[model samples]
Target: TDLAAWAHQDVPFDRLVEALNPERSASRHPLFQVMLTVGQSLGSGPELGHLTTEFVVPELRIAKFDLTFGFEEHRTEDGGAAGFDICVEYATDLYDA
Candidate 1:
């Protein structure tokens, strides 16, 4: 696929969007309705001497696309795959919660 072949290319996203020149709309993204991202997990917060710490996720107040899915792979102490933290964001104007 052209996308796969060009994955390593250093093209800026705005440039690509400009080149495609899809119909402009205030209610939708220019080229895609959905997006997916996979990345390393956000590790636990720093350790305090003999005190406990918790990882807190802030609230999502905005949606960048119609739908966006994010997967973060967590790793064990010994570098093994632990689990995944998954999250989905959707435009409330377009879809019901």
Candidate 2:
């Protein structure tokens, strides 16, 4: 599917778990938040994804997503690249439904 289609799809929970690493659970990485803003924007039902607020050390070296929020870059005080560095596994809620 295309990027647009992919963005509107629901990602499975198992897939998200598999993407994270087993170690580094105690690291002090910044938290990443992925909200179902689009769905709510279109006056849909409750938030699609049931998010579990916790640290996730990803082991997968996947390419950056083409989403506006997920793929944008950030500059930190330490002169290091900073951005959404964790996996966002959630089901999509289409506004056109």
Which candidate number would show the highest TM-score if scored against the true structure?
Answer: 1
Candidate models: Cα lDDT each: 0.88, 0.39
Clashes of each: 0, 1
Stretches of model 1 off by over 4 angstroms after superposition: 3-8, 42-60
Task: Estimate the lDDT of model 2.
Answer: 0.39
Residue 14 deviation, candidate 1, in Å?
A: 1.6
Model 2 / residue 7 / CA error / Å: 7.8
Question: Once all C-alphas are superposed, what RMSD does model 2 give against the true structure?
Answer: 18.4
lDDT of 1 by residue, 4-95 (tens): 84883788888888887899988788889999999997687679999988777688689989999999999999999999989999999999
Model 2, 1-97: lDDT tens digits are: 6997589468675565566543444322222323322211112244548853543347454322222233334456665755533334432331121
